[model samples]
Every structure is written in structure tokens, then in C-alpha cells.
Target: MTVRAAWLLPEGQTREDTRLAPVTPMAPESELRSRGGVIAGGDPLKATGAGLMQLRIGTGRAIVQGTDAQGAYPIAVTSPETLTVADGDPQHSRIDSVMLRIYDGLYDTSETTTATVEIVQGAAATTPVAPPLPPASLRLWDVTVPAGVSAGVGGLDWSNALADRRRYTTALGGIIPRGWGLAFDGAHDGQYRDDGAAGLQRWNSAAGAWLPYPYDSGWRPLALTAGYGNPGHGMPAAWRRLGSMVMLRGRIAPTKTGTTIANGATIATLPADIRPAGGKEFAWASPRDQTNKGPSVTRVEINVGGTLRIFESHDLPSWISLDGVTYCTD
Candidate 1:
């Protein structure tokens, strides 16, 4: 049996490996560019206590780009790496960024191809901004160092001082962690992400934004007004939302079976979020006579204020069907 490694050319081939070389790096690069960040489930450079001026990075793996012109590559911190934080300025506070960097000798002759973590110290000011990252680096976390901060005498506050900047990505276009500057283009349309407090979200190229996924509010019973209630049949007045469209179902009738329905009588009301922008009319099935013998068509109106009313009825309907009522909520 023979085994061939990635980026290996056929025997006796003299051509450069640029074509095949990019294949190996492009997978991670494309993923990182479109959905890259730290891979979940690993410690992935978690910051922990070491000393007042130092932090310990737990073992983890990440994918980061070198630059727009350079391909992305994977970096692993198999063992914990400890880094020292520079002492703060005496008069002004500053922010410092902890970054994971990939150094390629091909790009910079001065440096060898290696992955390492470093701290980029920010300038001191009344309001300090984090320092910009160098080429081919991924920001792990930001530390706020107050003025006069030093080791031993007064340790850095891990709670308020640390800001997590780590985002996450997955293979095969699975759910990734969303952060600022992540692209919402057609290439990533239909992909899902975790937007921190916003919960799960999906990219929509047409709407040009990330919308909440499964955009559904499971079926809820419609709020019936006075003189109206759900019929005794299995079907009951219910409403739900699917994406940008709101749907209604079930049957409604007067609380008293033989009572006549009034023109423009309010039957139920929709929730604010699922209400239609403008008035809509739907044809519904209703009982033709007091005996509930045959079906007849009736007009139902849903107003902008979310009021559901019977618009026109030939005679008193024992019950009205709302099974097919649907309208856009956008």
C-alpha cells in the first residue's frame, strides 16, 4: 500500500506546488474568512491566573488569516503558554490585547514560520482603545490595565478587566460564533451562528442581515374577544409565525351557538409582533344555517391593529373556519 501526503507532487514532477499548496491552506482560510474563529470544545487559549502581571493560556486550537493576500492556517497551543503584561502607566489607563499570531518565514525573512501568543500594549489615555493586531494574528482577549497597576502589590482584576474577543468556527459550514466584521455575503447565506446574547442566527443575503433562525413562534391560542369563543370541535383558534409570515388556524364561533354574528364584530386579536402591517381579508368557511347543515363562504378581515372580525355573513354562522388565513408580518 502507498500513502500520499497533502501538497506532495507526483514523482519527477518539476512544477511548483502553488496549485496544490493552496488547497491545504485554503480549506481553513476559506472557513476562517467566512466562518473562522476558535474551534469550540477546546480550552482554546483560555486566560487564567498566573501572576498580577502575567496570564496563562490554556491549550486550544484556532484558525486565523495572515492577511488578505495570504492564506489562513491553523494554530494549536498544545501546552499552556504564559505571557507577561506590561505594567500600566502611572497617570493614565490603557487596554492591552492578547493575540495568537502565525509567523511565516516566506512572508518575513526576519521571522520563522511559527505560531505564538503575544500581548500588544495599548497607549495610555483617559479612554484607551485596543491596539490594532499585526498581520496574520487573531485577537484572543483584551485586558484593561488601570493606571499604576503592578504585580504583587495589587493584582489585575480578572473579572472586570478581561473582555473576551474569541469567536468560534466549525467544519463543513456548521454553526460558528458571530463577532463584528464577520461577512454576511451570499457565500455564507443559510449558514448559522451564535450571536452571544442574541442566540442562534442565520445569514440572509436578500435581506442583507442575520435573522433569527427557525423564525417560528410555536402555535399559540388566539385571544378571543367577548361574545366569541372556540368551537367544541377539535380545531381551535390558534396563531403562529413562520419566518416573516404569520399563519392562523382552527374554528371560531359565538359563545352561544344560535346567536347571529354582527358585521365587523371582533372575534379575536393577534399578538403585536405577528400582526399584519395593513388590513387583510380572507375567505373562510362557515355554517350556512342555524342547524349547521352546510358550508358557506364568509369574509373575514384582519385589521392593522390586529383585530380579527367577521366582515360579511349571509346568515348566522354556527362556526367559522380560519384554517388558511396567512399574511406577511414584515
Candidate 2:
């Protein structure tokens, strides 16, 4: 399915009586000129070639059934010529949480004034159907904070503000709360391509460097998603895998010194031993790493000294074990 996001304006938001912008163009595709790039309004981005277009607002609602409560959505004025901003109109508006409705049971939500609608078409830049880059298998992590647990997972410290929508690159790390639980999907960033060896790269914050994730000291198979490649390990090695899923569970730490876990590990056992101490954040590592070989992992990650867990399996029929633990095959 295709997903799309937009900004919904109130009934009188565009009213002449109110100092708001009006739709300038009647054509379907509108033009917008921003500081960084140009956008065409109503020109929603397609994810797949034949997928249906769904709508979502800031991190809320999934487009299924009675999913989203009716509300206004914010949309980018694609065409400046089509949209007319009243002279000296207020730059921003603080309204209720944004919501979007696509079809019946297919939608997404956004927190910003507007929603980001990713239409599900055959294939577009927004929706590249080609196989995911390199590391095929991925692990999912669920972070939860328990009440009265003295510790709390620190918020993601995105170097840039949440408002800036650019290619964000930062060390991924956080704490797992002691009480409540939070679950989300995640994956490796890119293919494995180190200046020296064949393993994946690990961040060394103290030394300020990029060393290989210890995948067998000298061999590493680039992990894409889960269940796509032959599971194996070692450094200086590369395996072209597809994609898979992972689950993470733990308590939110009170501080930033996060926990580390290797990719391909079990998600259920995390909460017991990984709890934070003295307000330090949680750190995690993955058994997989991305290489210049294949698909690019985008969504989620965990970190610490940048050296979480490492893997070396090159090919395995089912989920295997490393560091003495069996993990689900991605």
C-alpha cells in the first residue's frame, strides 16, 4: 500500500476573514519553493508501482479501520502559484495533533503541523522496490519503561532538531525504562565497507574512530535484513543478504551510557540483565553490519561505545548462535 502525509487546515484556516494562506492553484499539481528544495503540491510520492496511496499524520494512526479519529491534517503547499499565503501570515500554527486517513485501514500519523504522505505506487524515489542494500536480516527492539523503576530511558538526542528533515547521521543510543515498554522496528544503516577490512564498522566514541564490529577478529558478513543471507560470521568478509525483522525489549535507562546487543539475538531476554545503573543510558550492538555490498538499512539502531555485538556466519539455513545465544533468522 502507498502511504502519504499532509497538513490539514481548519475550516476557517484558509478563510479570508482569518490571516491564513489560501489555495492559489486549482490544478492538481502545485509548486512550492523552499530554502532547500522545490516541492510540487498534491504530487504525492509513491512507494511502490501498484501500491495504494495511504495517508498519515505525525506518528499516529495506521490506515486500517476506524483507525484515526477525524481531525485536520497539515500539508505542504506543493505549488506556490497554487497556494496564496496572506501577506504577513503567521509563520506557524499550533493546532491539535495531525491525523490522516487513507482508504479504510491504511494510514500513518505525524507530529508536525503537516503529515508526510508516502503514496504506495509501483516505484518512486520514496519507494524503491529494489532489494534492500546489503545486510539482509534485521533485529527489532522494544524499549519499555516500568513505573517506579527509578530509571528512565533518555530521549533520542538527535544532533539536529526533530524539525530538520535531512539525511540525519548520528550515533544511535538510549536507555530502557524500568516499567513501561516501547517497541519499534530498526535496521542497520548501510553496507559494510571499511577502509581496511571486510567486517562492519563500529563507532569508538572515546577514541573518536570507526573500527570494525568484532566479527571474528578479521571477518564480517554485511547484514542487510534478517533471513536473507547465509548466516555466518568473521571480519573482513561480506555476505549479500536480504531483509528480516528483530524485536528488542528492556527498561529505559535514566542516563545515556546505553547498552549493547549483537544483531540476531533474542529480544525477550534483554530486560533482565541490561537494566541501567546510576542513571546511565542503555547501549546495544548488533551481530550484523552493513557493507558497500547491498541494501541500506534506514530505520532503527542501538549503541554504546559504538561496539555492541558482532557476527561472522556467512550462510546458515535457519537462525544460528553466536556469543553463545541463538537468534531469529532475519
Candidate 3:
């Protein structure tokens, strides 16, 4: 049914600054009786919520949804003005910042603050008269990747579908300070990527490896507790890593020789951080001969836990140099 035509202001809008638009009910003029500025709405001819209102918005138009003649209701903004938004001049303020977060089902969440552009209205690429973008460096262009929307509706503001803002921290979009950056406490494989100021490094949480770029600044060589649960000698195993490569060396005098030492005695334990990336075996060399003590030194294995095992040693006092390279982390 037809009701009194009046101006309606948008929600959250200030009463004074907000402008109300003229409206026309869908029913014919004679169907409903209008006196003064009020409308007497009824059934069959009025008061029904089936009627719509037509209004002119800019060079385009809009149709407002109907509601109870007594109660006010917002118009369902059906459709858009394809010719105006895509072909006419629109007003907007400059947005100084924007952020984008990408989430994969695997719990792999990452974000980028370097999003380089702001989306503005104007899609009339087919119009013979080309539309101009805002002056002074503002630009608009078509890209292969588009805002996620129905086909043919590219670059429409779909940012409302973005992830929750609370999930992201303030350190994003700023030159973050290390050691005090984020307080994740600790997480599985808690990875971090740093800028050149820290030398482009990442946390090798799985292996406990250090990071580097120019090398010297972020790396250090240290001594590992040589020997596993069994400590036979006071051997010191020194190790250092750069990138994925590891270098370790140590010397130990075995108490057992030959088959007696073949019990897989762990002579030196390396750090728990190195992984066997190169697949290279640990090598040992001794000056002892067949007549020395037990049997000649044979083979050894360096574990990721920094454990160095002497598979075969000859004499009780012969010194053997044990060394190997791995890409593992502790």
C-alpha cells in the first residue's frame, strides 16, 4: 500500500549534516488518499509492505524497499548505477595505510603491509569517452588479480571479508625492534624474517640453527659438550654454523681399541641444533698403527644432537681427530 513520502537519513548519520532524499511509493496516486503531509495507509490499497519507492540518486536512480506503513524501514539498496560509478566523478579522501592478511587452512597465517594501492570507483573501460582518475598521482588500472567478487565486478571494495583486525599486532607496518618485537612466548617452529638491519635471517626452530647474511655479525662458534651419557675423556668439540652449512671438529683419546671400541661409544656430543644436510659421514684420523694398541681407527657418526660416536678406535691413549659438516639445527 502507499504511504506518506518523506526523507530518510542513513543510520549513524548526524541529524543535521545528513541529507534526506525524496521518495515515491509504488502504488498509484489514486489508490491511497493523501491529506496535508500525512498518508492514510490501508489494505488492498495502502499500508501493505509490498510497495516500493523510487528515488533519483545523482545521475543514476534507486528503488527503496517497502515496510509497514506505520513503522519506518531502511530501503534494500538493490543494484548499482553502472554508468555513474564507472563513468562519473566520485569524491574520496586519501587513505594513508592498508594491510592484508592471508590465511591458509594449514594454520599458516601471514600478512603484508606493503600493499601498494588503494581501490577507487570507476570501471567504465568500455565507454567511448574515457574517464579520468583523480589528479596528482592517483591512478587506476586493470590488473590480472582482482578483488574477490562476482565476475565483471572488479576492484570493488571487498575488504570487509578480510580477517579480524584483532588477530594482527601493531608491529606490522613499522620498523620493528628485535628481541622486543613480538611476545608469542614460544610456538612450534616459530619462524621470523628480519630486514637487512638484522641480515635477512629466519628462526630455524626445528634444528636450533643460527641465522646470517654478511655472516660475522649474527654467527658465533662455540664448544659442544663432547660425549653423550658416557664421558670417557675431556675432549672439547668446537662448532660453528653459517646459513645451512656446519663445521665441527674435536679430538679425543679413546680408552678402548678395535672391536672393544666398536660398541658405538659416543665420544663427543655436538650441539643439539645441527642437522645432517650434506649427508656426509664424520671422519676421524689417528697416527696410530696396527701395532699401537687395539685396532686402527675406522668409522664414526655425528648426530644432530651434537653426539659424536667413535665406531672404531685402536688404542687406549691414541688421540683421534673427529670432524664433519652438517646442515642440521638443534
Q: TM-score of each candidate? A: 0.62, 0.15, 0.30
**What's the best-to-worst order under lDDT?**
1, 3, 2
What is the C-alpha RMSD, rounded to one decimal, of candidate 2?
25.4
Alpha-carbon error at 180 in model 2, in Å?
33
**Candidate 1: residue 320 lDDT (0-100):** 73
Better of 1 and 3 by lDDT: 1
The C-alpha lDDT values of all candidates are: 0.71, 0.23, 0.31
Q: How many residue pairs clash in all the candidates, one count each?
A: 2, 142, 19
lDDT (tens digit, per residue) of candidate 2 on 139-169:
1111111212111333222221112111111
* Top candidate by TM-score: 1
Select the stronger candidate by TM-score from 1 and 2.
1
What lDDT is reached at residue 217 by model 2? Answer: 27
lDDT of 1 by residue, 54-115 (tens): 88888776666665655566555656888898888999999999987766667756455455
Task: Provide the global lDDT of candidate 1 against the true structure.
Answer: 0.71
